[model samples]
Target: MADQHTQPAKLYRMMMPDHTCPYGLKSKDLLERQGYEVEDHPLTTRDETDAFKAKHDVETTPQTFIGGERIGGYDDLRVYFGVDKPKDQQSDTSYQPVIAIFAVALLIALGLSWFAFDSILTVQAFQWFVSISMCFLAVQKLQDIESFSTMFLNYDLLAKRWVPYGKVYPFGEAFAGIAMTAGALLWLAAPVAIVIGGIGAVSVIKAVYIDKRELKCACVGGSSNVPLGFVSLTENLMMLGMGLWMLVRLLG
Candidate 1:
């Protein structure tokens, strides 16, 4: 049987009218009740609605369809929900993973609650990592370069100049990433201390799976490891947490 908990697959964006809003909200709630995740693109203007119609070739509003066929609208939905498929029909199917994930999260929370001595070392290492990364990222964001032009130009920050070829930005970014990596190693002190370590790990995980590989590999381009898009986001968030930790420690 098809998994009822599978989210409703949305293939197109939609602009909905206020009159249709009630029906749409009801449909979404019912979908959730039946154990499907529903995502909606509520549209406001006629132009926006027209754009969606043009884009996906959808005919009407307040419709329930999957794989481009009209499943049924509110009236059909009313019948389905009325008797054949009751509200609790799919609720019995256990989503066992949720229980497992919750257990793990609870364990982690308890571990974090316990006091530890190395928390100080964690704070120091995390702050050092954040400072260096902030310096590097501030520089990279400042060095805005086009992807195609990067094939021919380069920039050097430590040397304090631009070479005008693709070489400069990439090389400088690479060196700067080493600074971020150094910061991430602070996790040994608190595991949660540097904060950036988790993001870096996830980024590294995602980068390996990408096939087109368009993102700037600030960490290791020539080497086997390639940088992922989220790597930078994770790095920034981690550094922010680390910096906050330092301020709190110093003041407290």
Candidate 2:
């Protein structure tokens, strides 16, 4: 067999007037980075690209070929090079999405407070931050209610008892969040927040502390890879605090 270093890998990529295929560029770079010489084949026109695809019996561009073997696209190239592509895995639980939600909510609240009251650090800002976060979290759950309910039922006591509660939970959360955001209808929002938050806190505590069951949290939504533990506990506690704060303000 010929030495791999002397032989160049063939790369067919699109280089059109309006669009240059990003994956094609990436494939070229990857091959170069892996110490392989590349015979770059740039299809300059749409028709040319289409003809190349038809002739090769491939559906996409950025196709790589080495020693008469097809190596597929950018993702395939990574796999062949023994590189791991980023994906959500149970072993690699992340809280980045949850953190980002809260961070952005706080910034938005701060901006609103500055515009309305000429201040960022205020009770209203805190309230808005929490309310916005609730709505965002609810949106995540609502996106795939089926998946959220399944994960929720694993730990949520109420969801386990009343199967329908899992489905209704997102709606209730959204309603509470909207009401809280408006700073109106305390009678409706406060109770809902308190009831759900209280129940969630208790359930999380029981599952994590009492039973010591290791599971994933559906807090950021059903598809999240966040672990069921302290972060989840903190979320429930924040809701409880918001509910209590609203109640005290309304009563006082």
Candidate 3:
């Protein structure tokens, strides 16, 4: 049997005057990692790269050939080496993107609070974190209201009955968030938060726990892959807390 390490892999990648294809370097590294001796072919100019692509009848660069067979691009190379590309990048059922947005919003909230009050952890900072996170999530929903409404109707009892509630929900969430962030319009923000949050909590619980229906969450957006359950429930609970707190402060 021939040694796999002795097998040569041919790689054609772009190397121009002003740009170098990063995927090409990645492919080379992967090939080496897989114990293959790589024959690097650098297309040094635009015309050269274009000509090579034309000859190979392929559209993209960093093409790989192993054992006298075309192995496609960087993703294909990973597949060949049995390396799993991130599921979030290729699959639809991933919570990583929503998690990332919340993570960033938390950091921003802490930074803003520290700059304004000289403290990273405080009641006001926590409020800001929830408010900003709400706004961010609302924006995602607003990007595709139609899609959001469809997904929302699957579980939200109010959305299923009224239908327009799905369309109006994002705007209401955004308005509540903005009002809370500014520490103004407590009358409007508090009621809006309480009503929406209450309904959302009940709807989520019934769908996930009672009916045992597994579904996607529309908290981050209509198209999000975040599962509809714990995270969604937590979001509603946070809103409830914010609303009650604001209402108490106003009353006191």
TM-score for each candidate, following the candidate numbering: 0.26, 0.73, 0.78
Question: Residue 99 in model 2: shift from native, Å?
Answer: 2.0
Order of candidate numbers by TM-score, starting with the best: 3, 2, 1
Residues 1-71 of candidate 3 have per-residue lDDT tens digits of 14655767999999888999999999999998888889999999999999999999999999999877898
Q: How much lDDT does candidate 2 score?
A: 0.89
Better of 1 and 2 by TM-score: 2
lDDT of 2 by residue, 1-252 (tens): 336546679999999889999999999999899888899999999999999999999999889998778989998888777685533422467889899989998999999999999999898999999999889899989999999999999999999999999998889889889999998898889988998889999999999999999999999889889999998788788788898889999999
Stretches > 4 Å off in candidate 1: 7-20, 54-59, 67-70, 79-252
How accurate locally is residue 162 in candidate 1, as Cα lDDT from 0 to 100?
Answer: 38
User: What lDDT is reached at residue 134 by model 3?
Assistant: 84
| CA RMSD of all predictions | 17.9, 5.6, 4.6
lDDT of residue 208 for candidate 2:
96
The window of 10 residues in a row where model 3 has the poorest summed lDDT is 84-93
Query: What digit string (tens of lDDT, one per residue) describes model 1 on residues 1-252?
Result: 165345353322244444345666666667667766555666677787677666656665456654444455554565655634644554433324223433443443344333333343453344444444444443443354444234222211221233353344344333334433344433232333233334443444444444434444443222212233454445535544654454454457
Q: Given candidate 2, what's the lDDT at residue 31? A: 89
